[model samples]
Target: MQAPINIALVGNPNSGKSSLFNALTGLNQKVSNFPGVTVDKKTGTAQIVPGLTANIIDLPGTYSLYPKSADEYVTYDVLINPDNADIPDLIIIVADASNLKRNLLFCSQIIDLKIPVIIGLTMMDIARKKGVEIDLDGLERELGVPVVSINPRKSKGVAELKKIIDLAARGNYSAAPRDFINNGALAKPVTDEIKKAVPGKSDYAALHIAVNADELHFLNIPQKAAIKQTLQTHQFNKTKVQAEEIMQRYNRIKHIMKSTVVETDPLQKQLRSEKIDDLLLHRFWGYVILLVVMFLLFQSIFWLASYPMDWIEGGFGQLSGWLTSVLPDNKITDVFVNGILAGISGFAVFIPQIMILFGLITILEDTGYMARISFLTDRLMRQVGLNGKSVMPLISGVACAVPAIMATRTIENKKERLITILVTPLMSCSARLPIYTMMIALVIPDRRIFGILGLQGLIMMGLYLLGFFMAIFIAAIMKLFVKIREKSYFIMELPVYRAPRWKNVGTTMVEKAKIFVTDAGKVIVVISVILWFLASYGPSSRMQPLHDKYEKMIAAVPADSPAADSLDKAFRSEKLSHSYAGILGHAIEPAIRPLGFDWKIGIALITSFAAREVFVGTMATLYSVGENPDDNNATLREKMAAAKWPDGRPVYTLAAGLSLMIFYSFAMQCMSTLAIVKRETKSWKMPLIQLVYMTALAYICSLIIFNIFK
Candidate 1:
């Protein structure tokens, strides 16, 4: 089979590159790690022509070919590495028409790579609103590449862009006619030497190799040695060479803009975005608004999701009962109903909350408020020795820590990045939502404060805030010890506020919900089955004697009498107490008893070490091990609510529930998280240290809370 054309969608951050990628590929995209790097790679198959599909690799949005962060380095490697598998046959440069001059800087750099390039101009609507205008024909003539105007948000001009891509695929599109800048003139000695050493590259590509040779992983030791020797021999001033190249490129861009573009003078009037920023970015008011937004966000999690969550819970309850009745009384039936079904329903019931959380977050992202949030939180971030860049990764940690840790690659400062990575797990990710929600519902009353704020909602918001503040506190302490000092700056572009794209929000909700159900669900299901078996069966020596005793006792009584039923309950309870899961839970119980966890909760703690969400399934399986799904249509919540100790004290008391929630909040329990941390830090030491510290922190905090509340 012939390989599909490899197309790279490249642009600056917030430059509509992602929008265009979504428009071109629709629902055909998948995200994975780039080979040999932990950075995310988003690839999709886009049909450029009838039966001619292109594999679109959406490279990280970078400001320039010059690399700084790990993200930019990845883009640089793919474009500069001659032997890379992702080298594009055609490059679709998504440029923001609203920021044409700055956008062109990167575009011009790519053009000098001498690849088949097509400029897809986005945000034209915003540009026109800002009194900026562009002539596509003139831009095409000057840049010597096809320029297609597109509004990816509305899917406008997408067909035209695809048609141009088809033209390029047919070898009908012209590459850049001339060098965007005089690449050789910038550093003649280094460029010439690099070109001689690394044959068959563009003059600009050779120049990149000259400056970035040592950092480029693709270059062999000999090639690197030769380039290094050449640079040393020529006394190549890389800084001067880069400055000269940028200046000359902008000088040419000025002339091109004179013919191809027109824009309002900045001093004449502020853009609408700046005017809005005045209010939204106000220090005091911005934080006030952020708090209110958070309050509403947390409130919506329960308010919007309550009905659906209840429906799902009820639906699973019915399904479990139906399966129990219809299927014969056997081990397979027990596993199917009490194990697999219970496990699925565990995470499944929380899908509504997950969807709402991601959907609302997507709304914040689409409207561009998320960027302002980073700006708003910059001052607070700096207090802990991080800049605005760290806010993004920390915010992303609320979704998942693995990718959030991967996101730290964008944080250029090693000290700040390391601190951010270590503390990010403290941010309560969506994985913790199920346990928090369940526990909150169990402990906090369904009442309102001041007749407006629901008590339950406030507690939920408080937990999230607790995680954030905890992360900040941890970061501050680590900031003192990390020792490495580097000057930090928070350079960021505030994209203009736009209406939330409902379709994109919907897509994100579905995508996140699907991930929770599939990825987390798999682990939860497997663990649930295992837990059910351990809870259902035990050592024959211990279990069989109790079974015989109960059987003889019940046989002497009337079969349908309450005494017979009572003996049956006692027998099942005794069987569970002696089971393998029971043994494991009991062994850990003495260590955890101070934190208000019983043997059943202890079992959950051990199982959920694999994943935080597995706690929900663990609870479902443990409590349902010997209970008949048909005899009891009670929801998992009710079953848990009725749990008791031998002394008849309720297990789900306020103090106990809150203590468990507190423990989960602080615990570094997820094995996957530890593994990813190891991957990101490229060492077992940090993750191990992180695990130990977090586990100790969780235990100490939980002990304190349990004592205080009890």
Candidate 2:
């Protein structure tokens, strides 16, 4: 019944902090927002010793305690505020052994907080490859803390890491005997005053609060006032103090490094990663490799998911048909089989494709190639009013725009970041994949050109490329109109390449697949139920008369005759036409008709505003209601393909499918994305403009595409 031991994992970005967390926690981790903020807080439970558990928190990656962005602030707040729920009983700083100096800066800062500390050195192999070696015992002696070398990706030294964490949690560990910086020398008066005001805080913690009092939300009005007064009285210059502390720390770090570590001359060595990057980062070859990667990604989305998607569709169809057969032919049976079941199956078939897409993305990230993608695209990004950093958010938009917009926080230039946010939605996210897949199958042939590339896969790749191109084009246009003047820069480290961790990759696949099914599925199912009711029932007066007329006509015709079947089809169509959904669709048909969409598609467009993926579910429910009993086991794709207008033209022809794809590629149909934009931009102005411009663009492009194809 003892409380779980608290351990926090902290590090600079790309220092293997995430890999360590994954190795320690395995499947026991959960991700949620930190308090009221939208930033992700990842926590997990690990058994650190016999009969004892440790609650490990993986904090946001930050370079220093002084934060410049929202994500960095979360890390700083948790570390400094003892009252935080995630405040650690022990701190394990994961440092990159390959890049010791830069990583040590953050570690040195954390140590000065006087917390119990342990250094988990990662990338030992990479360091060795670079002809660098560190003496662990020497490092431990110099820093006066427990130091362990680990490779989290390979799960090496994980047991040793756990033992260290357990020992520290039980109070068997202490901080370095020597502080990295002398707080009194930096600002004796301010530090002394803060210690008196905030009892039990270390000199480093008190100093941090004094310098960042205005930005610290936990401090009360009186405490902030007192800190401000103390700073003024002492004439404490925060910038000067910080610069002095950094120089002093680096000087000591250099002395420690000379005695504890050895490195070969850079001119004598070339790393494997460097050799690989020579080709991958080459000006002309880099672009070619990037394109090939993207092409294969879209291709795999279809090729890998094909079998599983078929299984899901066939399984659901059979289940629906079985339910229809066992249950009596009644409205309740219809609702359960057609409304709810059909809705679930409609989107479930897409899970395999989503999982594969995320799995590949995770692999690219783990292998360190993802960073090079930004480096390669920096020049192109500049042309569109963005820097290399914006490439991450824009590419991440392929998975989901809500988090992608949040990722823009890493971009330092406000104007460039805003422009990136405004156009990110133009990238086709996974939510649109189902829509794209269904439409492409409806119109595009299954045959492959050149005997290797499937036409459907090619079309899918084209849509994704189109979306990316449109995002950049829109960003260019926004740059002209947005009136903020700011300089932008892109600075990033290219980590040494490593093999993808299969455990991490598999975990991501399951988590993302689960999210799509549970989160997007909820919206699709609820909307499908409502859509079913709207499509099934109308004004009682009209519905009753139509039903009565159909009964008489069907009764007059012979059973199993073509005439009877024709009359039955006519009657069901008439009933649906008089229904509420039909009325709504008809009302909007005029507006969308010029782009090759009809009343039914208009209904889908309106309902799918809840989520882009709902368009598939809407079609499923609509078609299920009027579907011939003989075709009960038909897939949604088959049903959509069979649909025809009153004039005998197919509803989802080549022109209409292409037009719809183009529209989704350009339009901002995701409400969640819009809400996130408003939250990030701090007003409705940017989101409104984004919506209007994207919608106008979608409509105009669809108009042109539909006309050209028709």
Candidate 3:
């Protein structure tokens, strides 16, 4: 049996760690959550040779070995604990060649683990373009490790790096050890005690125990008494001492880099990057560009998806009509047509819009412009009591709040991360778009608000801006009470401008779409089916008597008169719907009366919570159920416009429509978001809080709007 070698891929944040992992593992990677934590664990297998394999674990990105947040703590524990099931036999520390000074801080810490290690120097091309020269051989000699320069994005130098890993794993290579501390005075006493205790054990193991007293578990210490005595004798403050030693190693690494590395034109790249940054990060122009870009993004989602949405609506309507005509009219036929098929249609219409939005975001992220956005927005975010990293999650909140909350894992401060997660759901996600668009089209005038901005567009923009500012205000208030001492620094790497990677972008969009369709789709389908059954059948024999009376009345009408023909058609349609079923809708009619919604609308609201897009489908189904069998206009909007309240008012008045839009905008409606939040938060508590807060807010706001308008 051939044994697989374990290789741990470690790096600082934005050091091309993920890119290298993707390059090595390709399609073999799987993302899972770490045990008892929401932070992601990415693992994969790579073929080191024809037969041998390497199990690669891409640890969460961190700045140093020192653990700060929950996510970073997991990385430190996994690397330091030998008892871990997935302990790596060889550690690969990837570094950004352009940012060697910062990257080496992590490299120095990893070398202290005493494992066979290799350095992967990534972004060498970027470094070269900046006119920096690296003496690879000299740096290798100083670090006591093989250094392989790679461009993972281009698949350059990957093969050579793999060869170096193979050699290290096969024990065909050895280099002189790099020592950060002299330890001359301390080593004499430590060596004598180690000689007396273990008697000719490995020198590295002795040195490890001497320095890393906190890592006694990693050494598999068999005797507690002996370990205790050794620690007492050394007077070890393990964490502090280890940190001090790591800093010493970093100093040494910095010294070597200063000597071996040469800069031919140091100011050229900095001058160019700075000049471009000035305009992009300008206080006034930056805000203008951001607003314009966001407006364009929203417009693109609506305009681009219009044709496909119409196509889907028409296709589903035609299919349902044909099914009703072909199948025998019975409960079984009704269940299949109205229950399952209608449910599927409810969720499918929004696919085009979501796909377009996700595709655009992927391009922005891959092109590295998103990082610049974060930097540009840092000052404004700070006013809201959030760091620069909060910008990504807040922007993501526009598409969906669940993932936006999950994205807060990147924030190292516990309080800041928690605050971000709590407030992100306030932003209007795409789920709220259907309600907003429908109401805005009907209620808001298309006239300009200052002869420049369209009134309807301005209101839409104001809603989004309101939510964003509210999130900030809430975060700032929370920050005043939460006592946390963690320091934050803005040190993100600005990757060189490059064309978006089409393969990665496509893969991300497909994966996100699949997750939404499958996860949220399941909940919506079930809710739609249940709602169908509720609206189709009712209790008591009251409906039967009404149906019989209506039929008799229709039969008595004069056959040649136009009034008689219209009355007969209406009578039959009403009788058929009321027979055993429509009365149930009437029963719940009072419950939603306060919000100006009838029983049918109430049913739609309940089902739409599973997904907001289901609102249109529910309306379509309910209207079709009450229409004459021969009626041709199957459009929900047309049917809705024709509907009336008991007082003879239009069912969908401007006030009612606006109230509904506001309700959906504020509500926690998507089940998939709830599910993701549950997964990311690792408990029902946080998601439950979000659910309650958002739902209550929605109801109260809608109630106020409806009553005021009434």
lDDT of 1: 0.89
lDDT of each: 0.89, 0.88, 0.73
Model 3, residue pairs in steric clash: none
Q: Write candidate 3's Cα lDDT for 482-549 as tens digits.
A: 65578786566676556787877777777767866886677667765666665555444755676677
Candidate 3 RMSD to the real structure: 4.5
Looking at candidate 1, what is the lDDT of residue 216? 81
Q: For every candidate structure, what is the RMSD over all alpha carbons to the true structure, in angstroms?
A: 1.7, 1.5, 4.5
Worst 10 residues of 3 by lDDT: 179-188
Q: What does the lDDT read for residue 265 in candidate 1?
A: 51
lDDT comparison, 2 vs 3, better candidate? 2
Please list all clashing residue pairs in model 2, or write none if there are none: none
Clashing pairs in 1: none
- Clash count of each predicted structure: 0, 0, 0
For model 2, residues 551-571, the per-residue Cα lDDT tens digits are 898899798999998988887
For residue 671, model 2's alpha carbon misses the true position, in angstroms, by 1.7
